[model samples]
Target: MLEVRCLLRSVRFCSSAPFPRHKPSAKLSVRDALGAQNTSGERIKVQGWIRSVRSQKEVLFLHVNDGSSLESLQIVADSSLDSRELTFGSSVEIQGQLVKSPSKRQNVELKAEKIKIIGNCDAKAFPIKYKERHPLEYLRQYPHFRCRTNVLGSILRIRSEATAAIHSFFKDSGFVHIHTPIITSNDSEGAGELFQLEPSGKLKVPEENFFNVPAFLTVSGQLHLEVMSGAFTQVFTFGPTFRAENSQSRRHLAEFYMVEAEISFVNSLQDLMQVIEELFKATAMMVLSNCPEDVELCHKFIAPGQKVISFVDKAQYICCLIISYTEAVEILKQASQNFTFTPEWGVNLQTEHEKYLVKHCGNIPVFIINYPLAIKPFYMRDNEDGPQHTVAAVDLLVPGVGELFGGGLREERYHFLEERLARSGLTEVYQWYLDLRRFGSVPHGGFGMGFERYLQCILGVDNIKDVIPFPRFPHSCLL
Candidate 1:
């Protein structure tokens, strides 16, 4: 039987037909074609998904978008070149003459010689229709098809450009980028809102846990970035973070991206806040300047008359825009607007308080520092001020978005960390963290900025879900 099988395989290999061969043609993206005025009258192949198809008796016009930009290229084809498959949302390829458009709406257009439909869309079954201004909530249901919309396409481009700008900022500032672990043994925030990680098919009992320890999706990468900051002096990480938060609010998400940076030899909260301000300002400016068209599309539709954040040199250079958390509480207490959660020194600040505080600061980014130590994590450095104990922490509150960033100087003293951990019974679990303090520990601090909030602040987007490509919330993890 083995010999017969071998003979059959050999015969099949010899009798198999060769695959078809085709020459690859040079392609032109809509963005490049629009920019290239010198390429007029040249023959080129353009490929993209059909945005709008208008049929006439003599001329067939189609607006195609390749997601390279917000603008779509106009393809002017003969009426005879039209096909049933060339409908909205369908993909197509065309060999055409690039010429000046007769209509002033566009500078140049594609005068097509050959038209081919690469993929067809079922218009009736499609969840989205062309040229319809669909609400963001309605678009949320169809995650797979949402990017095909103009709003989402522009958002994704802005997101991509912002990501690149972040990397570029860190690179130019001599900061090392670290890819922190997605799965960690310790809950960095200690919030108890962790997504416990386990293998897919098997439910291991307490006696036999995977890797012989409890692990979870990390809520923050600050601790891991701290480990690297020890040697590098400056390190940054930008990636997805998970929190098992059950709230269905517009701002909350189960999975979101965080931009975290740890700087070594930082003694005070002021030093850490400077880096945070610069990082946000530089990246936001880059996104605005590079993707102007995309930004305009989002701002015009989602947030009308919204202006991008403009930070001045002297404003950021000076730290006068900061207020102590105690002062913030006092201001909130004096506010006429009744806050759901009353302003108190020991309690955490809510969104209403944050909004009031930002408004009090002339709608500028306000840095609220020295939060109550009892509410903060064990990692924050203690103020040691009697009666009203506070931590060397800071939270950046913006006008549109409440709390955009939060961070503080770490507890670098050995005795302080030991006692804090002992009080919480985390001494055994975070021994590796303590070990870093034992030898050559320097004063270090870091901060984490919510990437989605940054986008929201810059683009004037209302919901956090609209910024991210695949939003993961309480009960929704659509593909």
Candidate 2:
């Protein structure tokens, strides 16, 4: 039971009443009041964009979707009526009684007696259609309009539900919602490449004294959030986090949303991974239960659409489960035929290895913990006994996507923190972060899970661009 209050921030909604309305009986989404006992005599109004309009010999069926469910309402309108006037992308409201029909196995459907077109999309101009098969790459190009399609619409909705579930899980578990600044002066992650904004309308060169000092877009919010954790006890921030990495891989994005949470008085890396695991379990259950329609939509469109023709009806395409990096490598050694990249200890798992591990070895999400320090960021706590260069970090990977999450227990000692920063050549800039340790910082750990990546995983969408209504990638920037 998901209750969503439509606070349309980025979406543009039609105002000033697109059409005359009859008495508004509490409007219900297709999934919500669909199969209720009161559905027999219930007079309800439902509004959504038309998914498809089909006319039979004497009856017309307009499959309408509100981004609520993959199963569209089979609106049985009279053939004498004008359904040709309706079009895709048209916002409509239908008032009717809910009834079970034998034509389909659907539990419930709207027996529409009155249909009103609030807004109509021109069929010729609308890029999406019921019959045509569009490429995923082509759909990525049109991020904003992609959601109008049933598959993309369900993806966006599932993404929304997952996002809400994250906040709910944390909020319920005593995590304070902290709003970390987007424009910051520090690159705490020590990732060299970043986007820097200047006052003079040019890329600020550090040597030229632009803006007097170089200030780049923030790569991570962990360091600043650490400062807040001392007072808040448990704090988390969810917002757009930027990284200027120029990698054009399908996994990396220039700008994305991160859910960064830091807790005070934590002891070890084990504590951090436990929290991450719980978060993953809660989120997965929420999606599986609440977003059943969206999940089915993913099965129909993204998985079985064309590329996944063989495993359309199969019980499993890619297996999902939790495993360590060492375990992942061991599993990879046995399943050589399925993967192109061979996984090895101390080496970062490629997207292909992640896909194979989940597809064949593990039938669920995999958590690869205790990564090599040389590969991990400078702030991760080091493991001196096992390997000097290895650190205590964990990355959550799924079948369709790689590196959905990256988090670890932060190095708490002042000297070790200073040593790592100095070795990485970031000492001068990160002195303030070390000051947190000097004053009253306790052993703390946190992780950053990109909101878009979670969205892609939940919806089973291949590309991150489709999940976000307005995506800011390396190439495209449009509202």
Candidate 3:
């Protein structure tokens, strides 16, 4: 009876030994599996859209992409497992053993054990056909599906990395991120190109409007950042800004993202310029280091074989040239190149003038500082230069993108700002802005950067629309 009891106990122990601990589902991203060191012989599940497929009697090959990386993960399947639904653009869930790939394109591939099509795409009717490169302009027509193409995918990935890099730069340097309001009563740029906000349909009286007085989509977040800068010392904001300029040029957009920063107690314009230069260099280096493949893909598709210098290398070697606006006008006027707009002393620098200036400075970023007060907005500090009558303003001109950044020392004097506001007929509208000076004002300054333009500059993309996911221009608001 004791021996029988022992035998029963042994049986019970053996039955409860865990049974190899099978998982419900072991899904791995193509990116993680490809970069995994010891994933060979491991049963892993992958889900992605098929990029291409080649079926044969003995073995079949499938190229799948999950938008995690530039390269597609190759999947090797047996002919018996092949199905008619394994077509291009079809989304599938694959369970397979990871194995070493013999192909030179990738290091590891999946040997499929089971395949299930989650969604089958109709290849015949799909807008993005297989194995054909679509032009950027043609892709813009299908904004909804443009992301499936390799070019757009690459551009977006780089854009995300660039954004993260910018935030990382600021965070590392102890700058606080501020979210400025999208709708406000004051026009930040004072350019009078605001998109006015109103009640639904129509309203009988202005007081019956949503925000009471005139509210508009903000042109810039500079004022809000300045408000935050008073408390945080260093504050920055990244958000959508709107303008109703009605410009159809390649460089104009009705809506875009802006990166604005404000620093308190900044003594001179050089301090602001240093921040801009360092921010650009740091962010460019971070992106180049993290997303070299994406950047390379952009260059390959956008400007084939252009032989442009790497972003990191350019940032390291190219010393940013700081020239006064008066000096820039002199240089542009003396240049042999013909320009559509003549570079006058007080005129704002046109695209042609900016391009000429950058080229004249040996294809490096040029900073034109101390712009004429008459041309700049009212917030720029008035430089006490007698004859020139300039403001402490600056514009950072890059090689491909004419103007990547623009800013200056803000006019923090209460009386000066009040007079300027009254002269611009905006004193009542910006009474709160003047209050910042009245309470506790210090010598502060900042700059604003167009996020899309920065992407175009870094990637060497010619068209602004291609860089931005959804190009918002006049009368062209497509999904």
Give the number of the best model, judged by TM-score. Answer: 3
lDDT of 3 by residue, 235-316 (tens): 9989899999988877779999999999999989889898999999998888888888888888787877654446445796
How much does candidate 3 score in TM-score?
0.94
- Residue-level lDDT tens digits of model 1 in 1-479: 99999999998998796754633435889998888766558777899999988999998999999999899999998888646778899999988788888888998899888888898899778999976899999999999999999999999999999999999999999999999999988888889999988776657565676878888999999999988977999999999999998899888899999999999999989888888888877887778779988877877899876544343222344343889999988898888998889888899999888988887888778999999989999999999999999999999998688999999999999999999999999999999999999988999999999999988888888899999999999889887
What overall lDDT goes with each candidate model?
Answer: 0.88, 0.74, 0.87
Q: Root-mean-square deviation of each candidate, in angstroms?
A: 6.7, 8.2, 5.0
* Pairs of residues clashing in candidate 1: none
TM-score of each: 0.92, 0.79, 0.94
State the lDDT of candidate 2 residue by residue for 83-120, as single tens digits. Answer: 77687678899988777766756667777888999987
lDDT of model 2 at residue 276?
77
